[model samples]
Target: MDAWVSHAGIFSATIKFNEPLQVAWVNTSGDQVTPGSFSLDPLKVKSKRAYINQTVPFTIADEAAFSAFTSAMITQPNFTWHLTSDKLDVRALAFPTAHGLHFKKDVTLNGMNNFGRARLARRLQAARDDPAGGIVFSATTGLDNSSAFNVNLGTGSGANTVIKPGSNAVTLDGRLVPQTGTDALATTFELFTKYLNGEQADVVATGKSSIQADGRAVSWLSAGLTALELHVPFVAPGGAVSPIKAITIGDMSLEFSTHAPWAPVSNSRTVLAAMELPFGFGLEIEEISNRGRCRACQLDG
Candidate 1:
């Protein structure tokens, strides 16, 4: 097709379960989804514009593993979304007489209308926040149709970064994401393994767009999951698995979740806070303390 989206970094996605779920995905939207592909030339991602929905036997192996996973949720990182595409030359028209109005004039950010990156950045930073200070935005960047979370969670990054963190950094994987084919549940678990092992990320990062936040960008994000079965396949070497250990009283849905940007609080974000299951009833991540163990930029492995 001549009309191809070279920067459609991500597209459609979906997930299926091997068992039942206490939670489920209700997609009556009837969006026709077809198979797709992934490549570098055009940044091809998922094809069908469906969120990856899978039924997983969500489980935790050992305490360390559990800690790692939970840390991913609570750990903080400010992803500086550099949304300047090279297609067009963006520059500022700073008139010496404009009396310091609005950062700069013609500062290359052409109102974020022409490209997906700029648009996503605009929506991501719209909620009383700084343009370059994205705490945990992928989880809240439903900035544009080209965004993954906006495509997947049906209400991704634009949701709640923190169930209610009093900080700019939000959820680990930036919860909101563009649709893709990788099994999110499985991938999330795999990340834990890598974290446990402290291995180098699969894809070496390069260029100005790459921001290293302790591997948090690569390891943290997993689309919400659903299934009836109580089995999950995430096991670190020499580690054993067990059923998810979590309890809740109020609704764990994303509705009551707090919508705010990253800020310094007097206490730990997870202190006396409730972890929202996110989106629909995704795999309810067992709640635990934010021991500052989840290092998102670099992995221990």
Candidate 2:
């Protein structure tokens, strides 16, 4: 008898910016300029990573949405473009069929600018007048990878700030690692307990998550502690048991840290922002049985 293993599932996630991000633009004079701090809307993503080396990509192209926000900022006479802080904070929630997980990640990067081109200035002017004619920028990060680098931000180092022409292309690359803290885990436990006790109705109603399994909606009081574990069995040929051929399992884990004003206090149910929870699954194959029966098997038959 021979058997094969399989695992499949889906996940829904919501990402939100926890704090205002400073924005800056530079002119041809090479001087750093400060625009104003801006906040982004929440983004919802649904994806599945059933194999290793798979990456999830997202893009936004709503010029009108950005134009409406920036138009109001430009009206302020005191508005200057500049990065207010060196750190960025974001919060994320991942609700998969396996479990409900949360993450908080803090990214610190040296600010740089490249908006010094006549063409770029013209494009900026056009973008201000036309809702469909704004700029588009993108960024990507390794969900399950890490890297290291040494950087110097002091004046005289040409690498201190990023530069780009106004009408040209720009790409910024840097290492971003998860922040260190215990608040995310504490929140996860609290939420799990709430889910197990039928107190997650408010969480679900807020459009934060929907918990279900086996093609049916699931409640905390109904699943108990086993809500996190999902199992599926495969029967062997001829109802006979033999050595396992393969094994596949899903891996779901959380990584995050909390800072002042965002961290939860004792007995508080507040969830922190600035987290990354990269969850996925993979398979491993073991020994393969021979086409012909082994001596022990033949004798038994």
Candidate 3:
């Protein structure tokens, strides 16, 4: 392999937050999941290229526990996270300008021909006449491929727009990713665990080319029997023959998962032995806090 590679560039990405859910606790002794597991939101975050920046608030049953939990969460190896803002209504740009744009003035402009440029000019004129034309945009951006959504300037699709309330910051990355592998999964999980434990790890962060553990890192991780999911684009074996048929395989998935013991702490804390089961590949530990009670107090009188 050549040690001196040329350079890096920007990439497109897709993100999704599935409906909130909780994993049923399985006693390490049984084959089935325990029904009495605590109810909590196990955040499911999936993104291609990079993970988005989000701020979520952590609530605790007691004020004292809040600090411990927050501290542990910011430092635990078992929990998954991304920071949350106190004001849920605040909007942050999903794509930051300084970090998001990647230029390649030299790479052969693929599908865009002279005719396409002309058509784009006409479309731009039409857009200017539209109500939301003033939003910031780059003339060099690649066209939006998914026609499923009718995006306008303000609607904010491929074009970069100003960060506003409810706006989110997402990281876009471009690199050769493998489909699936055990060694890869193990290594990735180790990094993820370290990240949750407030340790440094290589995570594709949004807006920035790469993000380091800022000592305040918060990103979501998925739980799966075998692997967690990741989003990515694919190029079919044969390139598209027609511009209309430019089959840029976007949003294909990548998955990884883990199994560890969890303490169900509501008004009180309950601990169970670690559940050793088949890799359920989609189990995620969203928030793990450290609450200290006298060990003697936890024992039966």
> Which number leads on lDDT?
2
TM-score of every candidate relative to the true structure: 0.14, 0.17, 0.16
Q: Please give, for residues 179-241, the per-residue lDDT of candidate 2 as tens digits.
A: 245996576556434433434212111011123333332222122212112111111112232
RMSD of each: 29.1, 33.2, 34.2
Measured with C-alpha atoms, the lDDT of residue 221 in candidate 1 is: 24
lDDT of each: 0.25, 0.27, 0.25
lDDT of 1 by residue, 164-281 (tens): 1111222223322322456975775565455345342232111111123332322222311111111112222233323334533342212111332122122233334433311122
* Candidate 3: C-alpha lDDT: 0.25
Worst 10 residues of 3 by lDDT: 110-119
Candidate 1: regions farther than 4 A off: 1-182, 204-283, 286-301
lDDT of 3 by residue, 44-151 (tens): 222212332334432233433233322322222232222211211111246542322221111111110111111111111001221332222112122222111111
Tell how far residue 48 is off in model 3, in angstroms.
53
Candidate 1, 184: how far from true, in Å? 3.9
The superposed Cα distance between candidate 1 and the true structure at residue 231, in angstroms, equals 33
Task: Give the per-residue Cα lDDT of candidate 1 at 175.
Answer: 26
